[model samples]
Target chain A: MTLVESLSTGTGFWNPLAWLIAVLVAAVIVYLIRQRGESGYKKGTTQTVPFISGNPEPEKEMVHVRASNLYWGYLDALKGYYNFIVPAHTGVLNDYVLWYLGTTAALFVVVVFI
Target chain B: MFWNLPFIAVVALSLIGLATIVIKKNLIKIFLGITIFESAVNLFLISLGYRAGGIAPIFTSAPSTDMVLATPQALTLTSIVIGVATSALLLSFAVIIWKKYGTINTDEIRRLRE
Candidate 1:
């Protein structure tokens, strides 16, 4: 259990105690910084409203960002890849099973041949 | 044929599960399919450890005889724990999705795409 002397194990090694100490130091630093920062946030005030260059605030639903919209540019760039992939994820359970069966069948054939 | 029954059951169970996952439209049904799939895998693992007239690998007073492999049982236990956690997490996600989108239909939960 006390393998921390050199921590090497032929191929790789890890020191749990060292990692714990490092994490503790990092947490302390973050806590100190947060404690020192100005706490100027006030609820139900103009400060609470999101800044949008004086534009009228959008509806709450419109203002909220959904997960799907987060990667528009990346998805657009890889449109071809997504075109092939997204349809495959049609959210239909049977199609998903078909994919799994197809993969298993392919692997079985490969293993049998090999 | 009798000895091979468990292996055949594993295949049947997994295939049925896959079919359910592919054909089911309800989120809960899909989840049930996943659980079935997990059960089939667990069954397969447990079956691999079977031995004729083998005793459980306990170190108690009984004279040590041919023991069923303990590794697969241990692995199956771990898998069951993981499966429970996974199902809980997935179900929670489903609940959250329903609350946010007012539906549990995978097809309709495409808000991210917008």
Candidate 2:
């Protein structure tokens, strides 16, 4: 059978190609809906200010809040639940690596056992 | 029953995740939506690895003629790794946003630095 003829009918719901197309369509719809009637600046705006290496310019309407302050507000609202959460305040990349390792190990264990 | 159940669950989970990300305004919740999406893909990959009346993909003497597919297992592993990296990167950006504006609300964020 030719490849064209084979793919003529539905490949069934279980087909990976079908699933991928579904995902792509969903993503496109979401993006288009988000883009409707919005200014170009808001559409592609980056929240973070780009850091130019070693060139500190005049700050224009830039608000720099302390990391501690931000964490405190989020945690304060959490009340009893705040103690259980791990705060990702450390600027070091190693902490992220460790988090990835821990979560991956835990997920692997869960998948293997059940 | 097992052969088709996973496919149905994956599709359902994908729809749920897509809805969550599309409807939710909170950045953290959006990240959770992505996590859910990744989970659905992982489940799909795992389902693809299953084989009826088959043994594990291990080489042994007198091994069963039918062995579970190995490619999906590899794909699942890669998906999990990529999921971890993407989540970490997104969460890190969330942290930076919180530090910058002292607010996690996406609506509130838009009002600032205009």
What Cα-based lDDT does every candidate model obtain?
A: 0.85, 0.74
Docking band of candidate 1: incorrect
**Best candidate per DockQ, number?**
1
TM per candidate comes to: 0.56, 0.46
Tell me the tens digit of each residue's lDDT in model 2 across B16-69: 886667567677987888899899999998888777766888768436666766
Docking class of predicted structure 2:
incorrect
Candidate 1 off by > 4 Å:
A1-97, A107-114
DockQ for all candidate structures vs. native: 0.19, 0.02
lDDT value, residue A107 of candidate 1: 100
DockQ of 1: 0.19
Question: At residue A80, what lDDT does model 1 achieve?
Answer: 98
Clashing pairs in 2: none
Candidate 2 interface RMSD (Å): 12.4
Per-candidate clashes come to 5, 0
